[model samples]
Target: MATAATSRGFTMPFNLRLRRADVATLNDKNGVLEMRRKKRRLLTSDWGVVKCCCSDSVVPIRMATGSGNNVEKCEDWRFDMKKSQNSQVVRAPAMRFASPQPRFISKQDKFFPRCSPRNSGPQSRDSPPKRDTGIANEKDWGISLLNENVNESGTNEDGSTWYRESGEDLGENGYRCRWTRMGGQSNDGTSEWKETWWEKSDWTGYKELGVEKSGRNAEGDSWWETWREVLHQDEWSNLARIERSAQKQAKSGTENAGWYENWWEKYDAKGWTEKGAHKYGRLNEQSWWEKWGEHYDGRGSVLKWTDKWAETELGTKWGDKWEEKFFAGIGSRQGETWHVSPRGERWSRTWGEEHFGNSKVHKYGKSTTGESWDIVVDEETYYEADPHYGWADVVGDSTQLLSIQPRERPHGIYPSLDFGSTPPTDEPPDESSTSQ
Candidate 1:
């Protein structure tokens, strides 16, 4: 007797372990899929189990769901290294319904297969190339197969798995400072790198600047940043942080980047874990941002990151125009995040919102601008109104009401609702909402 395959549109679980080097995949006419590296397939179909042969290392079990044409293209997207894992488990607000077909019409119903972070995305301008071929190299920058410390995994404890590259790709002229290849992987995600810019005395190798991100064989121009990661365990948990740290760095970069990160994580006896991270960094004079983010959890994902900054004098006539934006969003739901401060002024320039689907229309004191715009003004007091919930006092007592007065927008300019938060409205406004 045999069991039926999981439903096509089912919420399949993902569990994977990709060892070093490149892996080759073999999909036969039969419903079976096979992958091999370094010429080995110790475990075959007769055993009714699939094993990723890492020399002598064992990776236990790997689970993936699909039938017929439902192969999942696993992807580890947009990461900043230090907090990559923070964005992993986010279940977007959109509903994801499983169905018999490979693709689902609703953004809410779409499904994706287990992704290979190897082909995940861009790490840098030019370093570890992305692999599309079925074969995985022992030098692949993926998670290790077995949590073993021996050379049994076919690659060196460090060299093969932990891939690192660095050089100065900032500044127009050669002065100093540097990019440090501080490496380490996030709790459940990709690698992270760093820069040693603040220190002037502790310089190493290349001492100048301006090195190409790709194919630049310059020295002291070692101004570069990169990262790596490793999975931690219990029995191995007793091995002192240092020993494990060494074992990890030998196989990852996060070990080096760890000294510069603040991680939030929880673990249990069964090895289940949850992790989130926050970090800040600067690269030359172009990028200035700080991020507080986390993903791949039970509920949803949250992210608050500053945008890349810019400022310049065009022909000296525009007179030093500059702009910056700050944004915050959570999960796949639309109309939930906000972006502010784009025009270099908070008072006159309005911030706008972008969501996935429909938006609610809240009742606000009409502005010279649209109903959505909220011009900054001196605070006296104000009541709030929602479509579902009737007009109510903002601070305390629900029955109490606050007075409202309109303030002038900068330069006597007309107000516009194109920017700023626009609360959604699917239901009716409070029976008879109040006005200014």
Candidate 2:
């Protein structure tokens, strides 16, 4: 009977398409219409237990109303199956539904084949196959089928897997795999896979674990394999003090006083040369002057000098006085003459005689001779023009003497006897001699 039934089951070719909105509306109704409509053909067909595959059509069903109205309503709708040529369509029972094939059983039975060697063993469908252990231990599962001559086992005591024949194992650090010409199955029995082995450092970012331990010793000091050591307690204390002082100084000012001090300290510590000091000094000076110098004048005075008398007195004491003499000017210090102009020109003898009765000529003679010169005023008793003279007599020839008198005639008279021109020569003494 099972054989006859299997022979009666035939594959049908059908396509199905349903609007999601229609399905949602059908679920809102009583839904009996959808069930009856989906099974209508199967219930009436000649086949005893007909099975149907859903195709392209809607099925509506009627549901009895919960209300006491004694009325039935459309409750829901579902997809329907269509009969294809040489095949019969049937729906499941009202409470039954179709389901997809079971997955766990199929996977457990190795229903799907795998292509990897690691998955090709007898227990491949159960757990992953244990890697080949012929090269070494189970942990040293290497590519032994490719290079039979190589000992593909990890070097460390942990016995980890390895695929390369040469070079040190990465050990606790996992081995680095890369393409090489040495291990794997190929056309040749002695085929080589693309893999290589190198020390951890041969690649990147691999460091070795140290055998000797590190850290402090019994006296709470670092192990003394070398002289290098950390800062001492006193050194740290000094640094703390310096840092606190700096912070205090910084907080005390609106400007960064501590920054400047620290910078200077650092600069000093670095042993700057004279040139560096000079350069920084100039920079600071210029900065200060620019910020503060605009209020003053070129001479740096913002206030005018007061107290006229005091200023005059100060001027007299510290400044030179300009004095205009008759024909010369002089700048004199306390008791000594600082500067003198050229000597005044002498008066012509004619003008001197006319203005001062010839006594002026005698005075000039006295001044030049530096000795007492007797001049006859009325004869008999002669008078000395000057008592002091000496050394003044050293004057050179009087031919170069300048005349101080004005021109005679229209220009001027009385004060001058025409000194600009030759004066009238005194009448020569009478040539006739008086008889004794």
Candidate 3:
């Protein structure tokens, strides 16, 4: 590659070619012409030659390096015949070449005003220093407080750093506790995130009442959920159970592909039964959540309700919260429903209430572009309450609400369960190795 250095010390590689036919000749001689007159022509004095043999006429000279790197033809570099003949010696502007060493060109060299005697004279000692308009200092932008409370830190064998912190305080019940472990690794652009939970427990033996655990993979494409009864007191029976599961699809041809379910049921020695369930999932561009809880006082009072909400890629949102309570002759039911449009230009709401034997309904709506309405209807009625309405009425023989059956693998939630003391590895384990 042939390289040419600019006056500014920058080198650029390019090919140059000049044919013999392109060379200029005077009196049948190339480059040098036999002196036939007193007049002379000068190309440049800086390159050493002041006078050239010949009549005072412009002679185009084609230059070719011995290495074959020749100059291209340019009209601007040639002298005019009239101008050369009228003057004793005509000289072209001196050409400058760059040094072999390379130099960096900064913005100040091209964009900023330069200091010279013509524009800017020498500064006086009494004058203030000029301000630099370059990058601003970090203090001017405000300091980050992320590492303010980092008490203990250390480097891992993998070259990543880890931090550990813990605190405790006395409270009305006993003492509150907190612990945290976090760090990151740059090997694969992977970060490790883990949180420590402080459960509400007595200072003596902070028994594991119940477990609430949740986690998501690095890609965020997969999620895991778990909830179980860890403290099985004598009041609870072996039948008491809880578990969770998750499902995920590969990235190819899949949209919003993830599902999670959680369920738990517990019974006390006093005969009070507690059961609840939660389920949610995504399909295509839409996602939804469903949850309902049930409680039996062991007498005749029972409460059951369902809460659900859903949103779509179109920005539309809707939800419902409804519940019903029944005893002997005293029964009450209430429900609320709402929906929102994609552009928030329109919305609708409907709600109703029932107590003993009276009921009322109210609804409000906002239409698109200058249209809206509000309505409320009150209905007075009396009817005999269902005295036999109870738990048996909702579930006949099975303890599990067949409709609320949750299915998934549990990633273990008990405090006693050993989730490795070491932080999660920076890289996710290979599937093949994990399966084995």
Candidate 4:
């Protein structure tokens, strides 16, 4: 290794080599050019310069051929040893080399193999094995074991909380009512004591008496003292009779038959009379049933207007009281029978024209009369008759019948009162007037 410093302030180590032919030129007068294996050239300078006598020496020569040839090759070569002394030596650049560190296997990785189901046997340490007990040995199981022991000990029979002492078994009820301690005192009180019978209603009275035998009294027997004595055969019979009377009364008033008997007997008793119908003047002036019946009957009357006679003769007042009352309001005159007016002359004429033709009168007595003898007329007929006796009497046969023939009238042509268009303009010339 060779170390040298450069002018650039860096030191480096490098290898050096010299050529065999340049060994003799090692003297310090002139510098030697050393060439090695066609790679690089190294120069060493000499301190001295030789003055030659021959001109050939002035011109340096280099051999161009042959392997053994050795000649100095230079062109105007000059050397300064003093300057060379100060020149720094050159060395090749240094390089840092690095590589990844090698790795070794750890102990844990080497000793323990990878876990796989195919390579390893079943796990023995992970979970404990399940045990099987015989069916007869049910005591080894969890909840089932406890239940079996409880059954065998007969604890479940009288309820789990109950326990009987030795030589003291459960009663016929399979339950213990009382528990006795080994040396406990007897239930009977010590020293003098008295016996007393009590009536529950008179607790203080019974307590004051030292001993008294209670017997049936006029007021009533106490239920707590003697329940059997309180209710006798006669008392039961009286209750039965009262219940029968109530049921009989309920059946009479309800239209529902016996359907509402229970509800009526229970809630409706106070509001009902002895006859069991709801009382009048209680919630209202009359019973609801009476009002309901009235409404039902009125509804039937309303439907009666659909009758054909009412619809045609009476118009909309068919089943109502309007037509009859109107007829009655028109008082009779002289010996003539009264008649009811049609709603109005316009209404009468419209209705009449719809049922009858325009013919005023004919041999058949007005074309408007149906086979049933009901009068019918047209707008012209009603207008002609309206001024005479009103439309009412005009349509009524009792007041004025239809003429057998057309007639003449003071107001143009009109239905006849007798046979012609007029009401007899010449009254047959009175007999007295003719004689005079």
Candidate 5:
């Protein structure tokens, strides 16, 4: 006789690729997917399970359906079993064809995975309480995987398992600040997983800043690998940003195979200007930007000027480029553009500047292979000005991003990641510390 795999619905996603170090830690002594013949052990608090909310039928059925009697008998047997045994049993209700329940997709299904705090909604019971960690106005920082105390560890109602740990210690920088790491795994229809990091001092306040959410569907064909970050300046006002990159793999026989995009944006206070660029195609392929934009005015309006550029597979080799600056008070707009192409061994470039009805002039390279040019306007010829000829451009000047002094990495941890990297993990505490 053969056994059937348990059918767990979509609870969450699973990792598409485990780290090489994680792959080396899998136990190989027993069968990969089978339980060993051993005595039953009691469940522990550090590994408690939450019974699924939908394990029992919520809607009542009519006696004429014939399932009514079966449900009653099953309930009676379950009561008797509970008195005799301590093990748990999960059962799904039988659905009849006559009065099939209507199912609707949830809001979570509409949005692809993103890391943001949900402010308005009934929170999940498994979610930990919001704690005030005083991340703001703190200067010291440290990372300690060994010192992290298990804050929460349990199974979610959906069959996904989650664990959270928090720790802090005094280091050379100063008194250490609080930080947390939470992650979960699930084998529902798909093997799905999510990890989110929170810290008090990173952004001068408590915020869920870093996240890595990756998982593959049950079929193992469709998958998503995503990483994102958030940074804040204060409790209100505006927020500077962090980086985000997401890769979504397509299913078999799907058009547009699949798409990959990675982009980073930085915002600063001249009313908060944003600059971001994203590229298409696999990460390894030649990176060509798909689109980019810049905005300002407290993020409520676009900047006075806008620039547009399109890139393709040919290494930004050639595409359209244009810029427009608007002056609403004067009811006028200034525009500039350029076109370029690699012809033979040299490059041919054309430049144009337009000021509505006032002036519209064009300039081109002096020759087919020349790099300099001159444009004539109103019977006067002027040489093209070098944008950087006057000032010496200094490169490699590092910007100080943090307002407070830097902190030291906690010792005894695995290879430490600089400012932004995946949080490290430590060995679990002894079994004696865990309680049922």
Candidate 6:
């Protein structure tokens, strides 16, 4: 292994994994072209220069490293050429390699931008570019994802340092979570522990805690204490706002009636909110939701959104003050919403084009709201047990920062549970010590 430090102060390792022919190909065409072959672990600079002594035009060749670790390390490099006595000499462009260190999105980063930069730049390899932090139009808010089993660094106002750890286990049902506000000064911050309590039956009908980190509370529990605490918080809480929900769903089936249920609540000093739905009807491409929700505020305002997929009717009511019924007729399979102003005024709106999948993940949306002033009105789904339990990003109008709910692994140690028929042991048999 060869380690070299770039001018950028980053250390990159060069492994001699290529065969003699391979290294020979990598030789500086300008220098002595000597080649060697070994294990194929060698990596070429994104642009491996092949100099031609003769001339018409000298071109620099580039290659993508799809093996082992070079996946993300490969990047763009420029090659500068000069013609002397009609002979072309290649001088590769200075490369700007992003630090190998992981680029993280803090709990404070509201700008998660897409990998496609708002402005284009030079690229070396063919692999897709990494997401750019939200500096432009797109939000690459992917704080929920990390390379398997890595930890995050965080701090508190008291100048306390916290370490965030994450991972998952798959058995009867996949389980995962993240612990936030943990490992600060004196380990004083609260650790919100969430583990999906799934009733694993080889048979269908599996239920899970849908919301991230909703199960078992962790150390320093200051947030919502009960289901009502979830409903009382008006604003979205780090783990509060009672947005935390539990989900249960029937197995996937084609042409059969598959159903799912999601119940969640939120509360604060002023009032409380509750949302739940049991949507079951055809499976595969034709599934829908039987959604219902109600809210009671101390301020005397009531809200409810319901849907009876059987009759294909979507209903809405605001404290007996205003109500609406949305139905697919004249060929519109959409829903509707209405509101009653505090001043005894009524306003209504309707939408069509129904699309549902996995109890969540909306494909498109209809018009906005006027009476409620909700810029975006939407109806989506949530499930109890999902493979996406730990990695999926929130996809609504929510702007609150979501922490990685913690797991139940031994403190300060990270290890994955292999769910295969034969679980992995601490060590595999040493071939050198085995009998002949």
Please name the candidate that would achieve the greatest lDDT relative to the true structure. 3
Candidate 3: count of backbone clashes, pairs at least 3 residues apart or interchain: 1
Q: By lDDT, highest first, what's the ranking?
A: 3, 5, 6, 1, 2, 4
Query: Against the true structure, whose TM-score is highest?
Result: 5
- Those runs of model 1 whose alpha carbons end farther than 4 Å from true positions after fitting are 1-139, 142-220, 224-228, 233-287, 290-292, 295-436
Candidate 6, residue 195: Cα displacement in angstroms equals: 8.0
- Residues 1-436 of candidate 1 have per-residue lDDT tens digits of 1111111111111112212223344222221112233332222222223333211110111122221111222222112334322432211111111112222233322221112133222122212211111112112322222111211112222322223322333322222232333132222233232222111111111111111111111110112222222111123322100000000101112111111122232322222233323222222211111112112222222222211111111110000011111112211211111112324321111232222222221211222234344233222111111111001100111000011111222353432212225532212112121111
lDDT of 5 by residue, 1-436 (tens): 1111110111101121212111112111111111123322222321012122222222111110010011111111111223222222211112111112113425542232222233221112111111111111111111223234546667756676656655664443232444455555563534443343333232132122233334333334233333333333322333332222233322212222233333333333223433333323221211122333333444233332222222223232322223223232111222222233323232334343322223333332233455555453332212111111000100000011121222433454332223434432211122211110
Lowest summed-lDDT stretch of 10 residues in model 6?
1-10
True-structure lDDT of candidate 3: 0.31
TM-score result, candidate 5? 0.34
Rank all candidate structures by their TM-score, best first, as comma-separated numbers: 5, 3, 1, 6, 2, 4
Model 5: residues with Cα > 4 Å off, grouped in runs: 1-151, 155-160, 164-180, 187-190, 200-208, 221-256, 271-274, 282-319, 323-351, 356-436
lDDT of 1: 0.20
lDDT string, candidate 6, 291-356, tens digits: 344444434333433432221111211210112112111111223433433344544444333223
Instruction: Rate residue 120 of model 6 by lDDT.
Output: 24
TM-score of decoy 1: 0.22
CA RMSD (A), model 1: 27.3
What lDDT does the true structure give each of the candidates? 0.20, 0.16, 0.31, 0.15, 0.27, 0.25
How close is every model to the real structure, measured as TM-score? 0.22, 0.10, 0.30, 0.08, 0.34, 0.21
**Could you give candidate 2's per-residue lDDT for residues 395-414 as a string of tens digits?**
11010111111112223221
Better of 3 and 4 by lDDT: 3
Lowest-sum lDDT 10-residue window in model 2: 240-249
Tell me the lDDT of model 6 at 137. 9
